[model samples]
Target: MSEENTPPLPGYEGMPLAMLRHRIRSLGEEDLHRLMAYEREHAARTGVLEVLTARLDAVRQGAEPSEGDQGFQPEAAPPPAGGSPVGPASAAPASNPPPHGDPAQPARPKGDHRPGGGTRGGR
Candidate 1:
């Protein structure tokens, strides 16, 4: 079947249902809390929302280690014995993000070779 023809992801079921599933699947525990807050405020679904909300609460209370917080890292580490970044700050967003080349920095001009800092030398 064509990609377009394929049924949409489960969350497409409805805002309350589909978003809850997608949020639960894709988001970290902290993010799930944020989603749960929004879910409770608007478009709340008792059954589906409860499942996700329970998960959010479970994470908060340390009732159990979360689904896969087991080994995920800020930058995914090579998997090891212990799980996700541990301790109080692990769930918080990174303050300094991993580097990306700065788009604002000007690019070096192409084929503009020079000697002694300019085109001073004779050919």
Candidate 2:
């Protein structure tokens, strides 16, 4: 998954999402459909193929017979307690911060500067 596409997680949510996908691919269709239902009812992972899996099952099965299996209603994701990290969140944290106190960094400091003071343009 692209870094941009990966949702920010406080912890291990990212890995299971990715692993669920890998398992889906490995399982091919049947197992994928079962997992799709589980994921829909649980995480409601926002992936194209994952979402499609549930729909495909619905179409293939013909008439869900009830809304419970049609697809999942989105639920609020919970805070993770513990697990090994993975995905975008698993990457290293920022090592280098800009050496400027002012966060905006609007312009370069002018030359011919006095102690702790500088004009709009260097004199």
Candidate 3:
């Protein structure tokens, strides 16, 4: 289809995919069919096809259009082992190292006595 004639993506033109899928449930059967045909003719992505097909099928099965939050809900990341949750007062004391070592200050072996390895300028 020509650029001007092609339909806009389900939600606002630049909306994220998760939001688009949620909003797609609100489209009428005719709108969904139009979008499916457009997608099949243009991008033809399997994920997009699956969502469109499922929503269309639901419409055919007499399901009412969804009106609530059906979009993705991200789970909170688990706290690091021996590390505290992030907050304003979670900073470690200056004298002690954090449970996880800091990358800014690398560790070196104590009392190093390696033979003739102090300076790199000598042959």
- The candidate scoring highest on TM-score is 3
Off by over 4 Å in 1: 1-23, 61-123
Residues 21-54, model 2: lDDT tens digits: 3223323344445545554555676783454465
Local accuracy by lDDT, each model: 0.53, 0.47, 0.67
- Summed backbone clashes in each candidate are 4, 0, 0
TM-scores for all predictions: 0.31, 0.26, 0.45
Write the candidate numbers in order of decreasing lDDT.
Answer: 3, 1, 2
Worst 10 residues of 2 by lDDT: 64-73
Better of 1 and 3 by lDDT: 3
Candidate 3 lDDT over residue span 1-123, tens digit each: 574446544233344556667778767788788777877776777887788899889999998876544233332245677855786788765685466677687766555445566734443
Candidate closer to the true structure by TM-score (higher is better), 2 or 3: 3
Native-structure RMSD, model 3? 10.5
Query: After superposition, which runs of candidate 3 have C-alpha atoms over 4 Å from their true positions?
Result: 1-4, 8-15, 66-123
